[model samples]
Target: MSTKTPTEDDILRPIKNTTSKWFVLFGIAGLAFGLFLIGWAYQLMYGLEVTGLSDWGSGGGVTWGLYIGAFIWWVGIAHGGIILSAAVRLLGMERYMPVARMAELLTIGGLSAAGFYIIVHMGRPDRMVTSVLGHYHITVHNSPLVWDVTVITAYFVLTATYLGLTLRYDISRMREDLPSHFSPVYSALTYGYTEEEDEVIERMVWWVAAAIIIMAPLLLHGGVIPWLFALLPTYPAWFGGIQGPVFLSIALTSAISGVIIISAAFTRAYNWDHIITEDVFRGLLLWLGFFCLMFVWFQLQRIITGSFFAGISGTYATQAMLSSVIYVGALAAVMAVLIFIFAQALRPSLFTKTRALVAAVFVLGATLFEKTFFVVEGFQTVEFSIYEGVPGPYFPSLIEMSSVLGTIGMVTIIFLLVSKVVPVVELHAVEHLQEGHEPEQEAPQEVEA
Candidate 1:
């Protein structure tokens, strides 16, 4: 076993260091994002028509397609990420502390991407100001779309507060160690700092964590998000009571898979094998598997309901999904990953961090594919009788597909930029580890007399 002790230097390396490799990666990410902007500009200049999206259940096209699918997918990943971080704090899951800040950052990045999809899907950027904000007072009570916007706003504020509160503690203590160029940024975040406030900050952060936990089900992921689809009685494929729990499961699954990917990448880049550790990967794999099982169970619940109990339109939707090769294959891929994760859990010898990372990547893609299919099929089979053949061979246009790469690049840029300014791992995490590694004082032996 490795015996290297944890230190502030380990956490601060990203901030203090500079390298050509980091710049190269940043350039590549920028290029990817820039390319997407060009695609987005093309869409904006001509129209969303360029995306092959059209009116609902007409001309074999969908009003909602990859854009909406990707939005939900990003939101799930974002919401799930905060939930993971909150769990680490509130539940005292110290093993996860090393990566909790990374998850928090992921939440910020994911939400930005999700929000970008909203703007891209809107076609006209002005509509947000004119349509949503202009009519907010009237639509707040009746519109699911408004509810989504409201909660996302609240979520963003809450996450920023959570992250900022934690950073004050880290940044103030490490001021001398951090780069001088970012002093203004650090000063603003840590404004009004005092050594005594650490205790108060701790309590305040705990309560914020509690608030996030409450919101996860009652307001955000399991509430308004699902309501967006469930409240639409006209769309039989979308309406269901179980959407809240189903979405919650997907959020957790997507979030865990995302965390795994982020954690693994950082671990490799920073030589954090001893820090992030094989044990951490194994533990994370088990959590991912649990959530995956929940996702599968929830899906099965919906599938059976749609297939049998959900009337004509819903049954047709379910049957259509069941018959689709793409849908079936995606579900099978999720199941295979789920089984592999569980097998690794049961037989410890079979587990490798590499396999866990691979599982994470596979599951992330599988969840996205499933979510995208869910979005498309809902429209495809909306009307069982009259519009039976309306939605056919639905696929995202090149521009639509490019949004995915753009959002990913966007998230990468977020992480890359943030790592330069702040320690990606929390200062508290390193200190906690430092304390844990302190050699114990042995009891004095009595003289034999």
Candidate 2:
């Protein structure tokens, strides 16, 4: 590692500099999102029929397809990011402090994408106010969808509070160095700033972290996203206790994989190799391996329960999953990455940043396919074909496909714009890494790693 001392300039480079690369990326993302909006407009004008979703009974096919699948996937990714960030604070995983801000930002972006999918799938934006929000009192009693909305909204508020409290201290100390144009924003964020409140803010953050840890795994809140499907007893594929652990594992894997990809990108783009070092990557990859293993095991648990011990419907869903080339390919991809990660852990010399990035991309893609398939496959019939082959297999329409790319672009834009405004790396992160200050290491964790 280089011996260069950390400074304000190191963290401020992203704000002070706006290079051609940033412009190019922003333009590409904008184009993708713009196309998605055009597609969305077309969808709104025509109706949900343009997307090829159909009724479940005699009408044939499943009503929930790419949009709902993607919704859960994005929500899981969002919840998982906050979960990781919360663990960092609660467990005092200081090695990951540099990434706490990134995870918080990811949660916001992912949640925005997830919430937007609801509007897209609903086909009318006003329905959010009229249908969900206006009548939430009646729906809140029984509708899992409403529960998801409520808890996700609560999650957003909690995350904003957590991030905002952390930001006050950082912004106040570096007010002079941050861009002058954003002064009003900073002023609002730090309006009541004082040195005395620092301790209180830390305690508040700690308690929020504790609350998240408790709530996330329950049948409500973050876990409610999966519970939306799991509670439907008619669908054997979706109904199970295993879904909580399975989805959480996939979520954690997806979130950490995203962090790996983003951490590497920022490190290389800004030349902060010393700050986000090899050790960080190594630790992240190992944790990823552990979670990936859990993902596979939980997946196995679902498959076994569905395939052997269940009714005809469950078996049919299992059969469909096993037979589908896309489904098998997704599992294979995850397995391949898991094997590589395990091998690298044993043979340290085999590890490389490029390889780690590849593993992350593989897991991300695999999880997306797996979740989308899980939702779609859950609706397929096990008893008999009601349509007698009249209705074709459910596939995402062109518009649906575009929505996926578009939402991804939207998230990219969110991160790109936010980097220009806030310091993506916390000021505390730099202080921890400054010369002559070695972070305290907990020896027990080393052996576990």
Compose the digit string of candidate 1's lDDT tens values, residues 187-261: 899999999999999999999999999999888989888888888776677788898998889888889988888
- Candidate 2 has which clashing residue pairs, if any? none
TM-score of each prediction: 0.96, 0.94
Full-model lDDT for every candidate: 0.86, 0.85
lDDT of 2 by residue, 343-363 (tens): 999999999989999999999
| Model 2 lowest lDDT segment of ten | 382-391
Predicted structure 1: lDDT: 0.86
Best of the candidates, TM-score: 1
